[model samples]
Target: MIPERVLLTLDLPDEQASNQLGEDIAAALRIADVLLLSGDLGMGKSTLARAIIRAMAGNPELEVPSPTFTLVQAYPTRVPIQHYDLYRLGAPDELEELGFSEAIRDGAVLVEWPERAAEDMPKDAVRLSLSEKGQGRTVSIDAPVDFAERLQRSLLIRRFLDDAGWQHASRNFLVGDASTRAYESVCRSDGTAMILMNAPRRPDGPPIRDGKPYSRIAHLAESVTPFVAIAKVLRDAGFAAPQIPAADLDNGLLLVENLGTQGVLDAHGIPIAERYIASAELLARMHMHQWPQRIEIAPDAVHVVPAYDRVAMAIEIELLTDWYLPYVTGTPTGDEDRAEFAHVWEQMFDLLDDAEKTLVLRDYHSPNIIWREDRRGDDRVGIIDFQDAVIGPAAYDVASLAMDARVTISPELEAAAVDAYCATRARLGVFDREQFETAYAIMAAQRNTKIIGIFVRLDQRDGKPAYLKHLPRIREYLSRALAHPRLAPLVPIYRKAGIL
Candidate 1:
């Protein structure tokens, strides 16, 4: 029996608006999902499909030819997509010959003339019917349960934009990271752009310690409050954090300034030395400030930034055993090993407790650092992704930058950045190079250990295997840090776990 569908109708005023709707639908598509486009010839079915394919491919000029002759056209993207036209199909059974089942196995499928397939079409497919309406078109969508939810969310975003006086703006989906948040570039009719941050309030995961989720224990932000609060603080301090023009804190949505696309990385994906140095200087400047542990979000509202204390650090490092050890060794962590791991980490945390504390933007790596060439001094490096910011040891962020997990930092460049940062601190007042380097080594080891488990968890628990490719690089970083005399205590523990 066919299930009842949740229908949504939109009156697209022009081809531009129809393309925007296509982009919106494309952003919601997941792998293995099917979009069945049902419309008469020249009823804008191919036009809509092209928009979706182009948006997903991240190339506006991508050539997406009609699949009427070829039957199917596949595009390699972050989420692979296959566009199919069944207008020339000889029979419904011919789909099997054309590898229809295999085509949607690891990617999305957009089928035009879906009626030609009749009962062969999956019941879960999202069906879109377009009809001519004067000079434009009207689209009616019959969405499955999952697609219905996405449609509702998309409608909410449109309403929010309308309320914010950007009703005619076009939205292009921006690539997202491993977080639950997503982003979109909203371009106005005047060609100006703003970034839309779609961060829903994160629900607490299953309690891992003391009836608290890992997010709480790790001091991860639960909503947009931390981001809004921290961005305001950074901007007020003359740093280049985005300006929030409109926000729906209750719904966890925000429209902020679009920090240009120029990043700290070069075309070859290597970090630019000058940009990294500027980033280090920005960190030094940020460290020089006396940041409040609590900030006023509004007249009566307040946000208290959590401290990255022993418990938080311990929870983070525990990922090493909880995920990575089992993944690499193919055995669950035994009780005895767990006890030894805890003891070693406890000792390490004791050493970290005495280090100088500052507002540590937990992730201060290349991916999060934007290079604004038009800006000067500290402002030239625009900072983002600080919702997980915490009051922690200053060396934590410095190490995060120097031993960047996503990108390789050469030894020469790493030394130069460390020296530049220490020099800046020295000019400010008192700086102990040896003590800071020791702290840097400890933080690097700790951070890399956490990352090893994180990458494994992302592959096992989240079904994202791409992160596993960086495991070797992270292991190298961990090895380098553990070689430091201060981190020797961890060497035996890692060796015993067979992770060395």
Candidate 2:
């Protein structure tokens, strides 16, 4: 007993408008959901289906031949989709011969002439009915119970846009990363563009310690407030973080300035030296500033920036023993071995007791950095993905920028970037290159080790296997960092863990 909770109607004045509507629906679709397109022959049903297929494939010119003749067609996109035309089916049971069940399990199902299936159609399927209305077409959408919430979310975006004075904005899906957050590019009627951040508050998982979830232990941002607070700090310091135009903090939504997609990486996806050097210099500049531990959200609201303390660091590295070691070795880690691992990390953490602490943007790499060529000096770099900002060792972000896990930063280039940062600090005041090098090496090893575990956890627990591809690169970074003499004490432990 699925309930029809929301019914939406739209008037498409032209084929362009119809196609845009199709794209919008495609963005809202998820795996296993069925979309039934109901319309009479030549009522633009196929045209809308083609638009959806093309949008999902991210190729405007993708060949999406109608399934009218073949009965079924599958497209391999980010989310695999099965397109079916039941118009020519001899009987409803013929769906079994066409692999309807398997198709639904694989990805989303788009069916034309679903009426032919009648009682055989899934009860939870979303139905869209189209009809000719003078010169334009009218569409009525009946969303099933499961889809009702998604429809609500879509309407929330519309409402947010209306409030932001961009009611007529067209949304284009943007790239998402290894977080719960998603984004879209909203193009206004005047051709101006902004970014919409959809970061729903995640419910806490099973308590890992003291009735607190792992996120609490890791000081992960539970709401959009941290992002807003951190962005303000960065922008006020003259950095290039996006300006928030409007925000629905309770809904975890924000319409922010669009920092163009010119990244620090080149055509080959490798880090460009000049941009990397600039990023390191930016980090140096940030380290010099005395950032506030707590940020003001509003007159009555304040966001306390968490310290990256020993407990947080220790919990992060536990991912190695908790997920990575077992994944790579095909065996669970022993309790004794886990104890030894913790002991090694505790000793390493002791060295950072008096290290220079500053606001560390945990993921300060090429992916989160936007290269604004028109801007000069530090402003040329636009930073994003800083919601997990912490008051920690300045070396952590430098390590993140240098030993970037996503892309291979050549040893020569890494050294040059490090040298540039050190040079900047030297020009400012007294700088200890040797002491900083030790901190850099230690942080790099710690960060890379954490990433190894995080990647494995993402694959095993989160069902995102794509991150596993970066493990080898991270392993190399860890090895290079562990080679530092100061980190020598933990060498045997790493070897024992089979990570070195």
Candidate 3:
């Protein structure tokens, strides 16, 4: 009874197989009070009707002789079963004479050749048809809401305005995360239901006069198949992620299973104390997912395509040297200071290459992690904002969560979460405590430096002045990470660049 579900053609090479399938359908629809069957001759129309009357209603021995000659057959069932073949009837009067309307009102009525007497058919009855396709037969059932009265209707019909492409049916649309490019809806048709996705071909972003390096938002789903693959793996592992109902692989239109109205940060009243535990569990699971050696994505195959590699990282760092310093101290990077930054970044990038790589969530923090009301057993955290996942240091995600740029976690809670993550990793035989803590420090330091640059760029280049308010917190995390012995050398270069 799930609408919008597409039924594959039903076919059997021999008569015996066809008879068995017919019996199955009959037994399945036995409880129905009214049934109407319509199909071409020699397409096994009467064969299916016979199977239902025999297998269902405990009438295995009842004789189901063809009603074609008599036009009607009555059987004694818990609910009277009336079979009518209307192929010969030219109008409603022929069927009305057999008391077909009264039969349906009395009990279950299975009517064959309904097209002959369509006008006389009961208002509340399931309509079925069979059509030959290639070498098989396709069966379609239309159980109107009035017939079953069990349909799940939409709360609002106006939402269909968004999915105007389907004129015959309506789809349910629900709001999604701001980062989401596609809208989700569920559509019901022919007694089968399917999730639908509505995405505009054109997206709104900065004006592209000539498409030359202006900031813009574009559909980048194709560039990150690994992220989607990992989402599938997580969902398979019984974690809660946005359900992908339908995907237009070519256009990035995805119908997703709706996650209801609640985000972790929005639902919780308490601060880091209660939330950190849930965040820790999800991060631990993400890090544990196996990283494939070779990744296939559009970006990977593009020739001479730019990646967010060392060169990109260096350009990003300069935003701090260029804009952030000016924002905070009203001073600019001098020639000598720029030289020091170049030297320090080169060394930092070199040192980072030696660190082991894993599947990193890139932006695994408060903004992306949603909490579940119940925390025990399975993960209560829902991780979102993961379009930028990458194979990088394990510390990348850990640092993003612990020293979050958007939300602050107290030192005590941060230590506890780190311990929990490390413990979980050790249980999985991935890494030991000594190795994890050391790598964590280096990654944390690197993340803080990048965030400082990002905050500055947002203020000067993007005109997002509100981010400047968090500069004090960013500076705090940077200072704390710099205190580590591993980042001692890097701190002096940042200090010379006025970052410290």
What is candidate 2's lDDT per residue for 79-113, written digit by digit as tens? 78999999999999999999999988989999999
lDDT of 3 by residue, 455-481 (tens): 777667765677777777877787777
Worst 10-residue lDDT window for candidate 3 reads: 150-159
Estimated TM-score per prediction?
Answer: 0.93, 0.91, 0.54
Q: Candidate 1 local accuracy as lDDT?
A: 0.87
Report the C-alpha lDDT of model 1 over 53-157, residue by residue, as the tens digit. 987876768898998998988898767898899999989999988889988898999999999987999988888999988888899999887888876777678
* Reference-based TM-score, model 3: 0.54
lDDT of each: 0.87, 0.88, 0.60
Instruction: After superposing candidate 1 on the true structure, give the runs of residues whose Cα lies further than 4 Å from its correct spot.
Output: 1-5, 40-43, 59-64, 131-137
Rank candidates, lDDT, best first.
Answer: 2, 1, 3
User: Model 2, which residues run further than 4 Å from truth?
Assistant: 1-21, 39-51, 57-77, 93-102, 129-144
Model 1: residue 297 alpha-carbon error in angstroms = 2.5
Q: In candidate 3, how many Å is residue 46 off?
A: 57
Q: What residue pairs clash in candidate 3, if any at all?
A: 3-191, 3-192, 3-193, 4-189, 4-192, 4-193, 5-192, 5-193, 243-257, 264-371
